[model samples]
Target chain A: MAGYKRIRVPRNTWNMWLWGWFLVAPTMLGLLILNIIPIFQTLYLSLFKSGAFGRGNQYVGIGNYERLIADAQVWHAVANTLLYTVLVVPLSVALAMIIAVLLNGKVKGTSIFRTIYFIPMIAAPAAVTMVWRWLYNPQFGLINYVLTQLGLDPVRWTTDPQVGLISISLIGIWSIFGYNMVLLLASLQEIPRDFYEASDIDGASKMQQFFIVTVPLVTPTLFFVFVTTIIQSMQVFDVIYMMIDVTNPAYERTVSLVYLFYNNSFRYMDKGYGSAIVVLLLVLIMIITYFQLKAEKKWVNYM
Target chain B: MGIASKAAKAAAYLFLITGAALMIIPLLWMLLTSFKTVAESTSMNPFVFFPSVWRVDNYTRVLNQNHFSAYYVNTFLMMFFRILCSLLFSAMAAYAFARLQFPGRNFLFGIVLFQMMVPTQIFIIPQYLMVDALGMRNSIFALVFPGFVSAFGTFLLRQFFLGLPRELEEASKLDGCNIGQTFLLVMLPLTRSGLVALGIFTALFAYKDMMWPLIINTSAQSATLASALAKIQSAISVNYPELMAASVLAFWPMLLVYIVFQKQFVEGIASSGGKL
Candidate 1:
């Protein structure tokens, strides 16, 4: 019988609607002006060529796209981006799963443990990046200090091109593992208590039960984390922005697509070329996302 | 059952404690370095816990030298306005999508969902240009405006609103309450957790935002705390202690907030992930 009554509006119905519209007005206006319009403008700007300071923009049909293909820097940025994503994503997700499983059991001071893991999640990225920058410093950094303590030679974390991407990935993993652990922990906990109980009754080993019950049930969340992490990892900016000074030797090896975009657009004020880089990034993201969506069915479990 | 279970639980606790220690190291280092003198901070020997000379001047110097107070004020203002706007806008749009039978409601809701997948980076350039066109560059509006329409918030609130029972709303309507009254009096109270989740998420993003504020606001007076912390890296070299001090001050409130709302954040993260 619930909700059977005729919906009679009050005398202030118009006012309610008005207020509702008003409440969303600024946000809607902002999305329109900032989000929608600028996308088109970026598209339009990409079709034209412009000089420094954005002067003398001339129309060129797909010429920017051709130039972008020939540009080794663009390709290097793409390769560097993929390398960063490849290095960071699997390590982060796997580490998160292990941590979440380890943390999922009944334990004394569970909340305290959760708080410790989540501290990094809540720590300001700039702060964490600064700390990581110090740790990655070639001299007197904690990381090198620890390495020397372990009787190993100190390696240049940011200065060496070969290790630079891996160094940044380590920071990325450090920042993201906590977040991914929290997410996977929720899914892990959702798994029925009876499943574990039944497995225990049947006398399966802990690792056996995890493989047979835990991993399969948590696959959906794992897949979700995987997709999101891939998408997010491709746009690496913060660690690079803070950790790698542009004047450093490993700058080219460490520059991501977004960093390159930032350099072209804001750093150098070459909006046209920057817009072209952005468009390529967008296309890259779209292709990745399209494949991810299509491939999600293969691994993602609904139940 | 009892003996083996207890043994397993002990092993689990040991693992969790190890993980906990690993995670807290960087943050603890930041806090420890904040109180260390310039000499001790970058010295060959790593100092744990108390410093040889407790130099509180690190904090004092950062607050005085770097415009920390203004950053705090700006960040606080940005978060307050951003949270208020997100709650209001997302709630209204969510209600319309969840309760009202409007044309294109489903389609519009779909658009909101689509927005969640499109990375905010894709929109940054356009958004920046838009802010420039609006002549609102270097203002608080630039900081708070783009974040107001949170598709994630709207989608989350919509799901929450949909999950709400209609009986209360019907009773309110029967008692001469209009749709607005029914929603306001009956529905709003029930959505407190949803609102809290959304509010907390918005506040966290607003607090931690570095990229947008760094892009738009060049002046330290109008800049956010995170951006100001980033400035410390570029501002000086070999001032690790002072930079760490600035970072500690910048992160303290967020850290405190996270600790206080730790349970809610876990619950929120869990539910929101499932919802996504």
Candidate 2:
């Protein structure tokens, strides 16, 4: 009986092991082919000048990288992408934090406000950008009309090189803050009621309690939101792509890394150069994330 | 509460109301403009608030003359398959990663995490090349190709699966159920919320996906709503009414779904925030 028990146990273990592999096989295979393999392939392809229709390729080791460094347009793209991230992340997060704190209180119409704010996050970027474009039109736009009503000169929202990135960033903040708000609100709710009660007992004012209790407790989530939002903003493509055309004067000022990669890879068919550009984007994200992680220990408080 | 607190609460309400208005004005403008005539839409001197005739012609014209219908069908088809595949494959893989013991599990999951960390553009060039090699361009299959495996869904669902009580699986095992049976009968049903969350996210991501469809399916007939809207915007840059109409048509389905599943959408998105 004991020998039979041991044999059955081993057989069951074998069966479980086989099933585990079977269950994971499809996803593993898909990721390997589509995602995992491609990372290396992109790295390799960046080395060679891609041939037409993806055929005969001549290896140009470090050549694409060299071109990427000297290319003024590539630098513009990097600067624009970073600037977009810089402009979008802090303002959106701060606004989201404020909104989340207010909504966390005994506020009426909380869900209604949430629903309205979140609409832009789910709306197709192409569609959202279209509406914004109409509104941002220098001539006959509602915004310009409003400006004229207020006795101020109508500002060129989408056309001007200086204003284009800012205009796109406004749309970025509008679309994204709701998502951050939801995240921050979730984290806010996780804080125990005891903390607030204790702070109140200690003669802490509402503002003081918020600064002393709420902010410290929510830092973990704040950190997460900041990291993810930065990564997301770094890859901004659709809104800019829809709003700014290559022929537009603001194209150089507004073109992001992903947009540049898209133009090079598909439009110009310079896949090698595009691959190199995207690799630079990947490195930048990793470095930023790495620093964020290292800095988390200093400010992010755990409860 | 003191008068000071009352004043603070009022200030909060004011701020929230203003923020909400800013959030919704663009959408309200889109809806209002779609019904206006081209002249009315572009009018600056008076700035038409409501359409003079409240025309449905823009909607009808876009639906009838352009590729809007095709975009609808294509986008729906792409979303449906992408959601279905991601749920099935991700659940299976997540179950294994969360519950099953296997060699190289950590290494494999590391790969998944690596996939999640990298910018999606890194995968695009090779994925495009792969689809081209398979002659799958300009097809629904091409649109649905890259989403067949979702590392994010796997990671998200694995967290859900891990949170389930282990005793249930033990009980099913003691009842003479095998590993597959235990997973299917005792475990899978418990992760319904996780499955739903993943599904909601997958659908949303699939719908708003612009670059892939734009790159893969260049033809009007094959384009998804997002890519098609982009095409029309570029094609008819100055036709404000038609463009607004196209924007409305492209986004209303998602808006409708959001309205109906408001609670679930909030919970799903919020849950993602927690796990991340």
How good is the docking of model 2, by CAPRI class? high
Clashes of 1: 0
Residue B275: error of model 2 in Å? 1.5
Interface RMSD of 2: 1.1
How well does candidate 1 match the true structure in TM-score terms?
Answer: 0.91
lDDT by residue (A1-303, candidate 2, tens digit) is 678776645776777788999999999999999998999999999998876656777799999999999999999999999999999999999999999999999999888888888888889999999999999988968888888899999999998999999999999999899999998998899889999999889999877999999999889889989988999999999999999999999999999999999998888887988899999999999999889989999999876
Best by DockQ: 2
The residue-by-residue lDDT of candidate 2 on B196-229, one tens digit each, is 8899889989999999999999887999999998
Which candidate's lDDT is highest? 2
lDDT of each: 0.80, 0.91
Docking class of 1: acceptable
True-vs-predicted CA distance for residue A111, candidate 2, Å: 1.3
How do the residues A71-147 of candidate 1 rate in per-residue lDDT, one tens digit apiece? 99899899999999999999999988887887787555656766677777777678888887777778877888889
